[model samples]
Target: MRRPPQELWETDVLTFRKMRNLLPKYVFKSLENTIKQRTKLDVSLAPIIATAMKDWAISKGASFYAHIFYPLTNITAEKHDGFLSVESDGSAITEFTGKALVQGEPDASSFANGGIRSTFEARGYTAWDVTSPAYVLETDNGVTLYIPTVFISWTGEALDKKMPLLRSNAAMSKAATRLLKLLGHSEVATVNSSCGAEQEYFLVDEHLAQMRPDILQTGRTLFGRPAAKGQQFDDHYFGAIPERVQILTQDIEERMYRLGILLKTRHNEVAPGQFEIAPFHEEANVASDHQQMIMTILKSTAKKHGFMCLLHEKPFSGINGSGKHVNWSVSNATQGNLLDPGDNPHQNLQFLLFCGAVIRGVHKYGRLLRAVVATAGNDHRLGANEAPPAIISVYLGKQLEDVFNQIKQGEVTSSAPAGVMSWDVPTLPEFPKDPGDRNRTSPFAFTGNRFEFRAVGSNQSVSGPLVALNTILTDSLTWVADKLEADLAKGIELDTAVYAVLRQIMDLHGNVIFGGDGYSEEWQTIAVKERGLLNLTTTADALPILKEQDIQELFETTGVLTASELKSRFHAYAEQYIEVIKMEADLVISMAKTMISPAASRHLSEVSATIMNLKQIGIELEQENAERVASLTNQMMDTVKNLGNALNEHNFTTIEEHMQYCAKTLRPMMDQVRKYADDIEGEVAHDLWPLPKYQEMLFIK
Candidate 1:
């Protein structure tokens, strides 16, 4: 039986409405101030709020609570504790104090702290993030109260994604508020960045997933030949959802709704067995937290429905990959969305200024944007035909580009209106169309009201990219505000001063805007040589941008991260890249040797036996198939040996050099080995093949 919308939606979440109803009016106001205004938390109200939260959670059938935090590994971490407190008289009573709710001590030795704290010094703190609401996570066995928190070291260094995100948001808000004031909005509200990440993923039957060692160990397949009828036919995009998958989606959406996540769209993505779910925009911090839970629920619910959710950017070869397109924007209660270009964009000075700020930010800190989304899994998706290219360029549609161009040329001109679309048929009514079409190939595209960052990988936490975007925008907005104030101080009129600043910005940073195909080879060449933009083709090329002095200064100047904290992130991400490649290299060797090579050898032996048997019967058989298998097996083993040797050659002097070796040297060697192994897969008998084929896994469901 299905439940009503009002009955099911947000029933498990302790949202602001729930809190307002549960707590006293005064306590609720104080907490709301803390959440909305970023003010200091009133300690006096914590006890009352804690008591209310406990009672509410208890009513929801929660016996335990967990302080959930996101560590550097781009995943959620939680340490659960019971509400039962033992007394000296052997009696147990449920007790949750304000202090316990506000603070938690979780051993951080095992988390990826990026050398922030030594293993011996295991002290870390989880401070409650009042901005993101707490909710009850229901599992098969029981339900637990999950409160999102920020993890930090004892020395006050930021050790988790949420801390930097919150700090970056603060920095952006301060700058945005200043800019809004400069635009003559004296009563500006607190500005915040918002995000709606469109998550793309694949699903394979759990039974088949368990049969493949590569899929079991890594989220992606190490080697598999392309399916004969893969997504090449272009039939799967927005195709009919399979019945089993539909049930899974319904279950996942119901769970998401209860957790207060507003999932807006679901459809078949370009690739077979691939799908995407997009949520409505929310505060960036809460959106990131919800994204992690969405991934968790997708996997858990898929498993219950006999499927394995694959979140890897490229889980299979020769098919479209997955990306988490982060649709980002900035807004406030006072002015509404800052990026919205209303009907007449020529007169929308506020929108133009804000849009110019983003342009300046992307132009100045494009490499930093690239570096944040760089990961081993994403390396396969970026620069491919299905995903955006490695170059970080903005795509403003024809209408907005025209307005910006007019501003650049030192004039105010008429803006293009959205035209109507109609067919000749009388029955087909006409509708208004957008001024310009969408460009899916663009890495950062301005779509309707927000910019969609299309390069983010499916498996990554949205915090890293959000932090980078907020920090860079903060820097850019601060620059814009300073310029405006300076021009105004010189007795320039407001409109003239704004146009002067925008003209200067366009002249300097306009090359980052492109409304063309980013995946084309011509654009790749022109973007670098003609436009002077970077084409960071690999993670090794991209991650080095994080360590640049300008990037370090950007973080330092904005108060988003200290010098040590930024350096630690560079180290941690570089180490992760190296480790991922190393792990994949090891898997390639193991699977090729233990699974692929043995199967090929057995088939070769059988073929040779058949040849001998036919010869005895005076009917000769050609050994072309057997010879091809034998040759491919030898080539694969030899390449695997070379890959092993390269992996063992860890005599590099710097982490940068090690990363380059992994990218330039070892990755190609692994691909070389895979080529041979995949060729063998084609030649081997289907019944004797050790691993599941791509055809079955992709099309079975």
Candidate 2:
């Protein structure tokens, strides 16, 4: 009996709404208190809370629970524990202890800890994050209680993305609170960062996905000639949703809503078979948890619908790659939205200062920001059509740019008010929403109330970028607070102090602000040569920035990440970069040899046979096609052998050197192999080709 989506709504989740109904008011309050105060679980109240959570889970048909954590890799990690316990008397009972609810042990060495945890010392802890609510995850076999958790080493170093994200948020909150207080806000609250990530992904036939080793292993096509009619015509953007996709979207939304995810919109993306789903803004930690789940659900639901979801940045060539536009801002209970420039000019002074702080942070840590999103998959998208260039810059729209320009020149005496767009006639409606045109090209753009960090790769976990953004902002805001305090102690007014701080920030870091097309090569050159900005175009260049002494000190001072933790993360990221590129290179070799070569060779054989037969008849059909096919097949084979030889050399003294070789030497070699392979694919016969064509994958399904 398939239930309609409306009837199935939240039926499988132990949401907060369900928790409210099951627990006593005070019991719920205790849980909230733990989240708000960062207090340890009250031992006496733990049983009560656990019982309520268990009851809610059982109501959703859950007989087991899983402590789900996001590890170094951008994927969900979980350890399922059954609720039933067999007694000595052979009786069975279901129970959940508060201690069990709060923590669990998982093997640390299994994750990408960058040698943080040795195989012998395989102990790791998963501490429950109550702020991100627990939920009931439904599977075909059974439902399980899913509690969001943070992974850490036995020695107390952060081993997972969530730990630093939470720590960074706390640091930012403290810094933002102090700054707000200095700005005359007495009733300050826990200012937390918020995010709204727009996830873009492609859907292809499951059969096709299963057949392609490249897509299966790399989440992208290693070799595919462009479709005859690609997105060049621009017909797919915001087009009507396919029926199958619509049903899948409905299923995913239902699952998300059940888990208390706040989904806002869905639409066809620019590339055919590509689409996007976005959630309304939520607290950064909770939003990251939901984002992981969103990706999970997208893949799981797509499987159910006979489609495979491709989150790879560039799943196919000759088309716009995917990106997760992470819209970020900070807010608190007292200050609804710290980034919001209120209508009143007097109140907006604080907003401008915070905005100025962001510019300063980005300018200072642009390389670090780029490092977080550096992946083999994303490198294809960063400077691609749908993505921002490698150079980091802030895009304040025309009106906001004008306001900031005035501030940089020493005084922001006035701000450009939102303009009302009139319809030229009395009977039409008017609006005031469009502040100015948006710059999609800018990697970091202030889109109204929030800054959209658009450079984040689609397949990445938002935790990394958020960790950097929050920590950097903390550094900048703390600097702003210190400067203002010094000026205030010298008897300066609040507005005067803020303006002075902003002026200094702009004068120093204002070069980061650009209101032009980021795609322009001229801007790229000017940004690096004239503006004194860091242009780290590759993971090899960017990841080293994480290990910089200043970056380590920044994290240590903010208490977001210790030096050891920073070192571990850098090693992990470097290893990941090396591993990812290696896998793709290996697959390119394998696919080119097994699939592409065979197909091209077979086509050549047929062409040679036809030409020879024509020569026998004394009717010379030109041998040009046969000659071309043979030449391409031979060239491709040689490149594959070259790539194979390159892959064999692994002796390296340092992680940095190894990563640089992969980035500089191995990557270009892989691209060279792909170039010939893709060219061979074009020349080869369609019927003889082993893998599905791009036209088939993109347009057919």
Candidate 3:
């Protein structure tokens, strides 16, 4: 049967409504109540829920179920279990109990735990996160029920990213709801932070991508020379989408929509063969899950179209890298967008207070914010002039900046108005968007009703950043609530109390707010030296901030993570950094010695023999080309030896020192090798080159 086009837009797979219709009325209502209240479903209710889930999966042709979890590695992990079971009579039967529906054991020691789990402590549990609906994933391997779960150690420690996010969300909700009541709003319930992540990525032909080892192993090209034509002309941004890419986009959207992802827009990006996808905002928890799904589906779907999707922050060296701009805001049913200025921003005391809370949060915990986005891939993008600077700063538009300045001085009399722009021709319609301009250079910018966290890497999970934002906002809102309570006790008017509380917040934290070019050196100096913001330029420098005393207290106070959990995260991230660099360094050395050298030597011999023939014929040519090739090859080989030597050194006093070596000593040595290798690439014949060139990989699709 032909389905209506609108039917394709509706969420069908594993959605709450689908289950609600599949199950008995009372049973589904009980399940809905449990999800809404964040409570455990009764054991009796679970059997009914489990049966309904199993029947739904069977209807979708799923013979197995997989428990999916997001671990510390910024990727999803799944363990599939078949439904077949043996009864006492030895007949085949499918059994799913409430207990089975709720829990499963996956090996924890195999995953990166930073010494948290030893070989003997291999037990880990995946408990159903009832809020994130389970969907039946379809693949050639066969249909399987995919359940979103929180991975945890048997001893009750959080062993995955989702746990912290859930905790942080709970903390933020409590604090926000308390503040709302203090401000005379009594009907507030379950306040949530929302996220709309703008995902940017590059699409390269799979055939070209496979030829590049770095692209295959590390999600980026490690040794490719610069493309002749980069994003220099500024023509690709918002340009027409390619036909092949458009097909891939439609396939991805179709799959994503069925899973309930609210995809909203698609377009070409600033760099050639690069594109972006954005979705309408949703609750942070669900939005992050959807973000991960989007990335997975993007790559898997592209492969079907013969394209390799590159999600690395900087896939190629000389062009604009990608970023996942996480648009964030907070609100509840009783309130609509706490950050919304609603025409007269200055007069909206509630908006000012909430916005002030964000300013304060960013200023006080900007280092934590920076730490969340730190990664080996992101190091090549952040503060590289095209992306936001490593230094964290908030960009409120000129009008909002002025309004805050007025509030700082004591009174806010008028707001910066968003005026209409009328075209000279009568046919064009008037536009009514706010006149406040957005600053792309700023790491965090307030756009309309939300803050876009532009510094987050393109390939990272949104959970870490969202957790930090929520926990910090919890702290800031707690501060506001305390001060407002004291002020109201003194018989001050609500508006007067809000202004005073916000004024104090602005006075203490307004240094983090800047509406200028964040990439400028002047801003860098002013930010670090004058304004007191930390510039953590590398993952090695930033990841350690996760264990800082202030950060420890921040997480502890909000119940987001314990001190031990934070330390474990620090160790895990450091371990990842070290492991990634070591692998890349090893790959670089192997490729240089084997692939690059052989290619270079072949070209050099061919050139030298041709020179000898020319000399015999009584004609002389410049031997500079031959000498340069030999010199570059020898220099690259020498650098490769140095990198190997550095990798062998294991005398680091601590993990931090080891990471510093990787970032400073090892990474630089690898780069030195790359410089010479890239030179050799230019000197060698393109037909003899073993790896794909950056231009071909970047522009061929």
Candidate 4:
């Protein structure tokens, strides 16, 4: 029997449209205003709203409800409770109170708290985020109501990603609203940052993935020989999607649409067995939640289809890695897209102010931007020729760069025109062309209207980057607004003051903009020496920027994160980095000893037997093959021993020092072991190899 296809946007979601029908007019209006405007929820109406929500879920056959929250780690967590309650007569009755809907208590001791809370103090709360809608999630067992919430410690310190993101959005909106009001906009609605993340991942056969312990445990292969035919031919990019993968894509889209996620694009990515899925932009908080859902659904649905979705940045070495390019922008109901330069960009003061805010923010907080995206997985991808380099530079394109250069030169000039494209063949139609070409090498590039942050790892959550971007913009916009107000007090005209402020910004911070190829060594040298940009090449190098004085002040002033909260994040990330490397290092030793060495020994015995049989027949066989395999196998085991020793050394004085040791010492040793193991893999018999090869996992899929 075939399951009927689900209708788009009509499945399990309890959207605003559904609520409007379910609640009374006044109650629905108040809830809508609170959600859309980011205003405080009316506590008096909570019971009414809770009753409506409970009835809706009960009608959908939901017996339980769960509060879903995003913790410090890049994953989602949920605490479930049954809706069934006992009456005085021992009969059953369903009960969901306003207080229950508004708040939940979950233990915080086991999560990564960075010493924010003691083990004895195990209390944490999950508060309802009314901005994000609730939905009934259907499973094979039954259906349940999932409410999006924000998790925090008892003292109100943020213990999850959502709190920081919501706080950052609020700060950004306050700064943007103030700036807009100063620009003489009498009616300025609440401002908000938006995000659309392009997710890239690889799909491998489950059977093959199960054969490799590293992939099963670490989300990536710790050691593997490069495939004979890799993505060097560039034939797999944008190619036809496999039928099985296509079926999974459709299933994912249906699930996404039902959850009110606006998935827009799907296609083959740059590597074999890799693919990308993109969604239309949404408010930053909701977008972050939706992104998490997309990742979860990708993994779960792929498992159902007999595949394992690999979100690790470099799941397979020597091939293009995956990235989650976050397209970000700021806007409000009063102004559509602040970054969109109208047809005449020179005359658009509002657009210039907002765009200049982004430019100045990127320049002033480049280190913070880098810190937010740093991780163990990202370290393997950055500066690898597939993703953006570690240096944080903005690409404004030729036309926009020209405009900024003119501003820096203290002059007003005409905007650059976007031309038309024509060909000699009259049969084909002419098309309008963009004013400038795109630079994929740039970490933060303006794609016509919004900036695409290309350095975020595929496996990481988007909330960190979104939080950084919002907080930085909050600071920059505040600076701009202050400057504008000071100039206006000096009796300068609005247009003249705008240009003067932009010019000052260009002169002071315009060095961060680059239009050249970021992957080139020449640019790296120039960026460090001439441009004064910090080349933070690893997580250890970048994560320390979180402790900088200016960063701490920026978060504090913006009300995005307090000093303790910010410090906690730094410790959490540093510990996470150290943990990931240690796990991978241990796996490297185990695989080399328990898997690779045994395979090499088996193959060596087979080769030695062949040579003996030939010698017995009086036919001479060369000993080179046996010697090479034996040498590599021995070298691999020796390196594994060294790695184990390095892993044992924990003489670090601080978490930062420990992180650096892991990056500088343990990582290199693991690489050394992998080098020998991969070489042995190349020389050993294919049939005798214990782990599955890259070629079989990638191509066979």
- By lDDT, the best candidate is 1
Off by over 4 Å in 2: 1-11, 344-347, 424-427
Q: Give the clashing pairs for model 2.
A: none
Candidate order, TM-score descending = 1, 4, 3, 2
Question: How far does residue 281 in candidate 1 sit from its true spot (Å)?
Answer: 0.8
lDDT of 1 by residue, 536-566 (tens): 9899999989889999999999999999899
lDDT of each model, Cα atoms only?
Answer: 0.93, 0.87, 0.89, 0.92
lDDT of 3 by residue, 482-545 (tens): 9999999999999999999888988899999999988788998999999999999999999999
Candidate 1's TM-score: 0.99
In model 4, pairs of residues that clash are: none
Give the winner by TM-score: 1 or 2: 1
- What are the clashing pairs of model 1? none
TM-score winner: 1
lDDT of 2: 0.87
Q: Considering lDDT, which of the candidate structures 1 and 4 is the better prediction for this target?
A: 1
TM-score of 2: 0.97
**Native RMSD of candidate 1 (Å):** 0.9
